[model samples]
Target chain A: MEFSLIDRIRERTAQARDDVRLGIGDDAALLAVPAGQELAVAIDTLVEGVHFPRGTAAADIGWKALAVNLSDLAAMGATPAWALLALTLPNADADFIDGLATGFAQLAQPYRLALVGGDTTRGALTISVAVHGFVPAGKALTRTGAQVGDLVMVTGTLGDAAAGLRLVQQGGQDDPRSAWLIERLNRPVPRIAAGLALRDCASACIDVSDGLLADLGHICAAGAVGAQIDASLLPRSSALLDWFDDDASLDFALSGGDDYELCFTVSPQKLAATQAELARLGCGATRIGRIVAGEGVCVRDRDGRQRATARPGWDHFAA
Target chain B: MEFSLIDRIRERTAQARDDVRLGIGDDAALLAVPAGQELAVAIDTLVEGVHFPRGTAAADIGWKALAVNLSDLAAMGATPAWALLALTLPNADADFIDGLATGFAQLAQPYRLALVGGDTTRGALTISVAVHGFVPAGKALTRTGAQVGDLVMVTGTLGDAAAGLRLVQQGGQDDPRSAWLIERLNRPVPRIAAGLALRDCASACIDVSDGLLADLGHICAAGAVGAQIDASLLPRSSALLDWFDDDASLDFALSGGDDYELCFTVSPQKLAATQAELARLGCGATRIGRIVAGEGVCVRDRDGRQRATARPGWDHFAA
Candidate 1:
C-alpha cells in the first residue's frame, strides 16, 4: 500500500522546474538556488482532528498543508523555490495520495516551486510540508525591525477563518456564505505579493496564523515595545459580519486564528510610501494599531472602553 | 504540556545564533542571513512504528529526528543555521517532550542551529524537523556533478545498523558487543564536517541512508555513469560479524539500510588531495569504487566475481 501510494505521488510530482537536479527518487532532492539569493525555509504540519476536522476533503488538506508553509515564505517576503513533502497516512491509497499531490502541484505551479524529496510512512493522516524560497540577503522581512512609532497594518480580512471553524463545528455546512468562510479557513490566499511589496516599507512583519492580537504580540515582543490596537480599525468583510452577532463576530476577529493575513508595521514616516506601495500592488492594507513605547498590548473600543482580550491563542501542549 | 515543552525547547536553543532575532516564541522565527551567503533548506519526518521501532527511546528518537535532516544539509554542503520542529504526540507528556527537546537541543548546539517556530498537535508520535543552513551561492554540492572517472568514497563504517536491527529483532540483549551495534542503529551520526570538507573536492555527493549501493545508484543515475564497487572495500565493524556467518553478514554489509554516512565522488586526480583533506578534518574516507562510462551500479568481489546484491533499500511508497 505504501508502495502504490508512493508511485502515485511520484507520478504526480513529475511536473517540476528545470533546476530540480534530483527529485522524488533520491535520498534527498537536489535543487539549484539562483545565485546571489538567500533561501527562505518554513515547515508546517497539519494533523487529523487537530488542525482540521476529521473527514475534511483530502484535496483541501493537501492545499492547506502547502498554503500554510507558503504563508511563512510570504511573510518573509521571499519568492517560492522548492518544497519537500512528508506524509503519513493510515493506509496508502494511490488515488488519495495522487489527489493530494495533484492539489499541491497545481498550487505550486504558479509559484514555480518544484516538488522535491519527501518521505511517506504509515500512521494517522498527517501532512508536513517544508518549503524553500529565495530573497535577496537583506530583503527578507523579519519581526525585529519594527520601531516604536510604527503603524500596525494587516493585509486582507480577519476573523473569517475562526468563524468558519465555528460554523463547521456547529455542523453548519450548507450556507452560501459558509462556502466563502470555509474557503477562507481551508484555502487562505497567502499574501505573497503584498508582503513582497511591503518589504522595503514595512518595519517588521508576521503571518497571522494565531489571531491578530497574539500575532501582533510577537512583533511587539520581538521589537521590545508595546502595542495599542483600535478595535474599530480592524478590517471585516460584510460576509463575516452578516453571519454572526456583533460581539461574537468581533471576538472571532480579535482572537480567532488561521487568517494567513500579513500583519506588519510601517514607520510613521513611511505611511504615505506604504499606502502608495499597496495601491500599486492592488492589495488592501488597514492600520489597526500602533507600536508604542511601553510593554504588553492594549485594545480600546471606539467608545473609549478598554477591551479585555484573553490569551485567545492556540497552545499545542496545553492539556 | 505543549506550552512547557516548547519553553524547554526554547531554553535549550539559546546557543543557536544572535542573528536569530526571535526564536521559539514567535509565529515564525526571524533570522538574518549573512551579508553574502545563500541558505540551503531541508526537511525530514520520522514516524513511530514506521521509521523507528515501537518503544524506541524518546531521547534517541529525538536525536535521530534532528540528525537525519542535518544529514540533508550536509549533503548540500551547507553549514547548519536554524531548525523548526513540528512534533506530534498521542498525548501530551511534559517529561517525554522535555527529554526529546533536550536531545535535540544538545545536538543542535554544536551545529549552531536554533529552535525556531513549530506546531504541535495530537496524533501518533511523529517528528518533522526542517533545517536551514547557509552556503555561498553556486557552490552547494549536488548529485548531478559526478564525472565519469571520479573516485567514489564513503565515510565511516556501514551495515552495523542492519546488524543492530537483527539483534533487536532476535531479542538478544546480552552480547558484550551488542550494545555497540544497537547504539549504532539507534543513533546514526551525520557526517556534517566530512561533508563540508568534501564540498570543494567532491564532484557529486549524497548521504548513504538507503544503503550504499542504492544511494550511490542515485548519483550514477543523475550523473549518467556506471559505478564499479569493490566489495572488499565495504566497511564493516568486526562486532557486526560476531554472530552471523560470513556470507550472510557480508550481504547485510552490502545492502543494509539506515547507515547515515556520506557517499561522495572526487576526480581521480584529486584522490590524494581528498585523502589529505579528510585526514586533516579527522574524518575516515574509504575508496569503495570508481565511476565508468556506463549506467547503473555493479558490485564485484575481490576476485572480480559479479556478486549478487539483493535490493534491500527502503522505498517510501513501495508495498
Candidate 2:
C-alpha cells in the first residue's frame, strides 16, 4: 500500500532550513542544534472528543495540536524550530491529510518551524506533536523561579477560548461574538514573541493552558511561593463580555483552559520593561497578581475578598 | 483531579544526567546538546489492535513503544539520550501506569535515555514516543547512500516476531518454542551496538520494521538502486524453523514485519571488518544480498531463479 498521506504532508509542509541536515525521510531526522543553545522539547497528544469536541474541523485540530505544543515552548521562552508529528487517523483520508497539513503549515511558516519527521498510524483521530526549540544557556524560562515579591501577569485575554468551547457546545455560534469565541477555541495564538521578550526577566512563566488558576498553581508549586491575583484585573475580550455577564466571564477566565496565553511572574523592578517589550511585539501584557510567601494561588475579588470559581481547572481525568 | 500518574512515572524513571538541565514536570524539557553533535530525532505511534493485539500488557506496549523508536536511532547510528512519551489510554488506571512506566524505564535505563517529558490523555490505547539521540556531525547513517555492488547485510534473525504473532493469532502458544517466538514479538531487541559499529563503513542503513523486502525496498528506492537476495541465506531463528516449513519461514522472513533488526549496505572491502567489529560486540552480522543497479528488491531461490512471496510488508493503512 502506498502511504501517499505522508507524501502529501511532505509536499505541503516542505520547508528549507540550514540546521535540518535531514528532514522527514530517513530512519530519523538529523538536526543541527546551534552551538551555545539548549534544546527545549515538548510533546502533546490530542484525542477527539476529549482534547477537542467530537467533530472539530480537521484544519482546526491540526492547528491546535501544534499550537498547544508551541505554547509549551513559549512558556520556556524557546524559539520554535523542528517538530515531529505522530498523527493517528481512523482511516487514510487524503482530504483530511490535506486540511491538516495546510493548517499545520499555516502556523509553522511564520516561525520557520520545520516538520522534520512523523509517523501515521490507523487508530482514533489523534495527533501527537513533539516540538524542539532553542533557548540560550541558562536563559530558558521555567516554572521554578518565582520570587516572593514578583508580580504575576498574563498575556492577551484568557476566557475567550473557554467561552468559545462553551458556545460551540451550546450551539451558540450564530452571531459575530460567537464566531470570534469559536475561533479562539479552534486556533489559539501561541505567544512565542511575548515569551522571547520575557526571557531572563520573567521570574517564572507558564502558558495558561489549564486556565489561570491551575497553571498559575503550577508556578506556585514549582517555586514554593504563593500568588495572589485580583480577578477583576484579568483582561477579557470584548467578544467574551458580549456573550456572558461579568461574573460568568470571570469564572471562565479564572478556571477555563486552552487559552495558550503566557501567565508569568516578574520582579516589580522589571515589570515596566517586560510590559514595554511585549507591547512593542504587539502581544501586550496585563498585571493581574503578585507572588506571596505562602503556597497555592489566591484569587481576590475587586473588594479584596477571597473568591471561589464555580468550576475547577480543566483536568484530563476529572470525573 | 489527581494526576498522580505523572508522579508515578517520575519516581520510576528518575534518571540523573547533567545534560538534562530540566527534565519532567516543566513546560518543556531543557536539554544540553553536546558541542559538535547533531541531534537525531524519530517519532512513532502504536495503536491497540493494530500495532499490537488487543489486551496486550501495558508493560509490553510501553517497552515496544520505546524499543521501535530506539531502533530508528540505531539505524541512524546515534546514541540514544532522551525521549518524550504521549500515551492515550481509555482511562488512567494505576496498575496500567505502573506496568507501562516499569517497561519504559527497563529499556530507558540501559541507554540512559531520560524520560524528559510526556502527556497522557483519555482515548483508545495508543502510545507515541519521540526519541532524541546524538551523533558526531556528518556521521549519522541514512538510506540515500547505498551504491550498486554494496553488500546488503542484516544483524540478528528476522521474521521471528511476525511468526510469533501468527502463532498467537492461531492459538499455537502452548510450548517453549511458542513462548520464545512470542517473546521475540513482544520484545524485539534493537541492534544499537551493531549499528554503531557500522558507522562510516556502511554506505546505507535501515531498521527492518516493515519486513526485509519492504524495508530494503526503502533503501533501494532512496538510492535509486535495486537488490537481489538469496532466500536460502535469509537468517531465521531455530524456533521459527522448528514451527514452520522452509518456504513459509522464508516468506515470513522476507515480507513479515515488526522485526527490529538492522539492514545495511557496506562496500565489499569493509565487509570483513564490519562483521568482525559486530562480532566483538556479540551482535553478529549476516551478508544476505547485494545492492544492484535498478529499483525494488528481488528474491532468488537457491538455483538463482526469481521467487515471489505471497504477502507484502506491513502497511499501517492496508485493509
Interface DockQ of each model: 0.33, 0.83
TM-score of 2: 0.98
Off by over 4 Å in 2: A1-3, B1-3
lDDT of 1 by residue, A1-319 (tens): 4335445545655564765655655444545656556557667889988888886777788888888989988898888877777788887676687778776766776786676666777788898887777777667788777788889998888899999999999888677768899889888878888878878888899999988887888888889998998988889888789898878788888888899999999988888888888878888889998999987778899887889897656765555
Candidate 1 clashes between residue pairs 3 or more apart in a chain or in different chains: A2-B317, A3-B317, A3-B318, A3-B319, A317-B2
Which candidate comes out best when scored by lDDT? 2
lDDT of 2 by residue, B177-206 (tens): 699988888887888887788886999999
**lDDT at A23, model 1:** 61
Candidate 2 chain A lowest-lDDT run of ten = A1-10
- Span of ten consecutive residues with least summed lDDT in model 2 chain B: B1-10
Top TM-score model: 2
True contacts kept of each: 0.35, 0.99
lDDT of each: 0.79, 0.89
Query: Which residue pairs clash in candidate 2?
Result: none
In terms of DockQ, the best-performing candidate is: 2
Quantify how close model 2 is to the true structure by its C-alpha RMSD in Å. Answer: 1.5
